[model samples]
Target: MTFAVAMYNLYDKPISNVKVVKTIPDDFSDPVIRETTEGRGEVEDNKIVWTIDKLIPEETVLMKFTCSIMVTDITKRRTGPIEVTYKANSSFAGGLAIDKYDAYTRNKFYVDTVERDEEPGVWDCKLVFENPSEFILQLFNADVYSPEDESEKFVDIDPKDVSLLPAGAQWHSNKWRYESEELPAFRKKLEFRVMPDFQTNVNGTISISDVILEIASITGGMSYDLTQVPTYKEQDVIAKLKIINNGSAPLNEIAINQQYFTSEFNPPNASEVTMIWDGDEVDLPSNSVKFDSNVFRISLKNLRNSDTGLFMPESILEFEYPIHCVNPVKEATFESEITYLANTFPLSQELEFRPEVPIIEALHLRRKFRIGKEVIPIGALGKYQIILTLENIGTAPLQNVVLMDKVPDNFEYGSYSGGKPQITDEVGEDTLKWTIDLLNADDKVEISYEISGTGEYSPSDAQLGL
Candidate 1:
């Protein structure tokens, strides 16, 4: 969130009145200036203003500040279009220049002559030009003469174009040889301009574009395998949590924490949990899992390593563990609430999900029935007391129950129990039926009947139906 502004002086002369202003984002806090190279910077209302009195040639002024985003969820969070206003005597930022001209100024121009002893009357001469004024100067041409009247030319200098010479600048002409009878002396004529009056006024305004910073967000859910579990028993259930990345930035260092009541459920230790990343199953490292009394927390600095994190754009991270349903005496509902928060300094997004365990209810379901058939020879042969009984012995109710028993081929119905039954077989062959609308848990029912037959007394196993 640190912002820096640099103003460079790309001119031959000093520039003045450098005022730079940058707009701060609405969600960001008031900025505090960190450092300045050659300017005084201050924070104003929703903006940072910087001012510099003057900047010498080749001088650079730098301003820096940190812009930290404190609060933001809105889509459009943008920063400044930094508008800069500066004025210089003559220069442009885009490396452009105007036509060059010259003006008059204080300058020096002369010639030096030297004679060698070996060659009689042979002299070497050169012309020198120096600018000692406070203004820039330009040189066009220079010439030298030996007779002090320019009658005989010794050296001529012309660069074909005007040469820019700044203040305190000096120039030298090429050497020329001359032959003289006496000690050589020379006069010079120079064409030059002192750059003082031909000045240009320059004004500029520059714009530095701002940038958009995206926000990071997260969302997810938790669930359990069983929705309803029968009471009076302990059961193992699988619990899973899914976290999805739905932000513009990648995420790292996740912590998943959950707490459950010990009376209703039991969370698994770290060794039993498994992790699935991006639809691929993997082992949940033991170091990442932590378990306390009734709460467990899982920590992961990243999925793979320090360099890797959540997938770019979007990815899925899942965790699963075995949880047990505590045996209960009555119907009860178990709930578990887990929290997921990204580890960020001074800023983080948290997510929560409540996954309910299976509901336990009172249930009783079992079936046990007894049937008996007895015959007693009381007085005569083939004339005996026939007895048949039906009983229901079960812990649960038997609804719409119909018990049926068939008589032998040679036997016939003579006497029956409290309720009479309809004949269901051929003539002289009948089936005894008993009907019960409802039978409570741990309840029993019994029915008896008497029959006479010519063969031995035998009855098949009873059949019960709705």
Candidate 2:
């Protein structure tokens, strides 16, 4: 393995006669001095040293080296514990002053996987550790980690708290059991300290690989208005479905089967329901469409792998269709079966439709006045005729229709024409109300009444209907 070391001058003034030394372990051989950024030095007594004449403020130097491991036992490997000694020239002292620095590398330990047991939706891991030094290690601890939301882990170690470890000995940790819908990758970290020298610590890591498969379905649609208490009839409704792949491995030869049903009405006929591709009408593909008594099935093939692979975006399939409804059913349901390699049982998804009725928005009322044969001017005292019209321009019919119109204060009530209106007198105004049992779509009603005004008078603005 190759390693790099870097040194920097942090003082404001320049430093002189700087030397850096790195000690090599006995278990390593074939030491090769690959590259150095500044001045160079040679290996002496298994130590690599470099000497520099001067180092300016904020200057840096880097060194690289490569070596081979001579020891076959993992516990016998040791990398580093570097040291540096330097001097600065002081004008007052008239001599070189010595300063020393020390640095330590992370000691090497061994963490290995002993074995693994696997079954559908479950996996168990076994791990082992080795200590290569002559000294005893204390307070040794190990922990395994997995995604919190995706998997559960259980671990067991032979001795709960390992207070002592003999030289060149191996210890086995408790078997780790992982339970999840899909196998998940895990990380293991081992930490320990050598006895009589608690400050000297060692840490090692191990990674485990896993393979998983995930699929999801999402749906959306539009339904007819129900607020108007509309008369039941055949109405067109649209629905869109999307299928996504969210797994690690490549998904191949994917087949999807979708079924739709209604409880209160017959399933939509194949001739009445049509599929659209890219906003254009098209016949359903023969290889993908299948129909039974009330079930409609659609199949898809060769879906690409999800984003967990080399691809950055997930693989997805989407389609839309319009179905006809002739009854006021409680709900319409759509179900799916997705099958792919290694997943023989197939994944399933169910979606129900219970759309809310929309509110009515098309109600209009108008008022007009005529005096015998001429239009009456404002504030004119005369016998004039008032006409009120209410129209239901909405698509659905209305029930229990009531129209209320307030007569101006200066006008006297007269006989009504066209339709009889219930008249009521208030402190300052009179109100005329007309009731209709039912108002069909695009229906209108007109009511006319004669009124005598004592002073200039026009129709009052207060008019309400339901």
Best by lDDT: 1
The best candidate in terms of TM-score: 1
RMSD (CA, Å), candidate 2 to true, equals: 29.1
Question: Model 2, residue 350: what's the lDDT?
Answer: 25
Please give the lDDT score at residue 209 for candidate 2.
26
Write candidate 1's Cα lDDT for 14-39 as tens digits: 88898999888677885989999887
Q: How would you encode candidate 2's per-residue C-alpha lDDT over 310-367 as one tens digit per residue? A: 2112445444554444444332322322222212123322222222223221122222
Off by over 4 Å in 2: 1-232, 246-250, 253-284, 302-313, 327-466
RMSD of each: 20.1, 29.1
The global Cα lDDT (0 to 1) of model 2 is: 0.51
C-alpha lDDT (0 to 100) for residue 419 of candidate 1: 70
